[model samples]
Target: MFSKTCEYAIRGVIFIAQKTADGSRIGIKEVAAGIDSPEHFIAKILQELSRKGIIQSQKGPTGGFYLDAQSRKHTLADIVHVIDGDQIFTGCGLGLKQCSETKPCPLHNEFKKIRDAISKLLRSTHLGEFSEQLEHKLVFLKR
Candidate 1:
């Protein structure tokens, strides 16, 4: 599972993609509202994303967040890496510091399988695809 911050980042990116696809730029306030995240927290997340080049940002009256062509093609994993690093894919389950293949945790094998599946899901899912889902009202970024 993703952290709360990661969850908001994913939702914020997808929401921005949806709006950008419709030729709109979204500010932190709009992105936060769209994804039902706290405005201040979402602002930091969005700034991190922009710094990581996952999403585009501008400054000025018309300045806001928008996805470029490359940004539209970004996968969930990309955003995850920016916000949460590779812990979800590389860290041990059950919070074991030394757990590994040789020194397996109790739930290591099962958790590895689950983690691999989640990784694959993130790598294969593009922002644009989620944007489409949101645009069509088939799925919502916010709970």
Candidate 2:
């Protein structure tokens, strides 16, 4: 799967997208509460997303997080790349530094297949879909 940070980031984005999809802004407290993440940690994640242009944020009493039309097109892979890099797609399964085709680890082949499948999924799953799913109650973002 994904790192804890990436997991929180995805949840945070989905929560924000669900709220913003209805043309409303959501505050950090609400987003963190919705996703069951720490407010400060989620704030940092939100700041990073904003910095990378994956989402937008504003300051002041009415300021909050919201997704733009272009941002709605971003896929899970995009957020993964921003927050976790491509390591999840390229790293060794057994955490071996030199594990590869030529110097394959015991689990390298199987793990490669799994990693590729995850990469394909992330690439194909856009935030908009998750937003819609959240809207329709097809999936739960928080426990």
**Which candidate's lDDT is highest?**
2
Q: What RMSD, rounded to one decimal, does every model reach?
A: 1.1, 1.1
Question: Per-residue CA lDDT of candidate 2, range 34-118, in tens?
Answer: 9999999999999999999999998888889999899999999999999999999999988899998999999999999999999
Residue 110, candidate 1: Cα error in Å is: 1.2
Which 10-residue span in candidate 2 carries the lowest summed lDDT? Answer: 127-136
Candidate 2 Cα errors over 4 Å, as ranges: none
- Could you tell me every candidate's TM-score relative to the true structure? 0.94, 0.94
Task: Give the whole-model CA lDDT for all candidates, comma-separated.
Answer: 0.90, 0.91
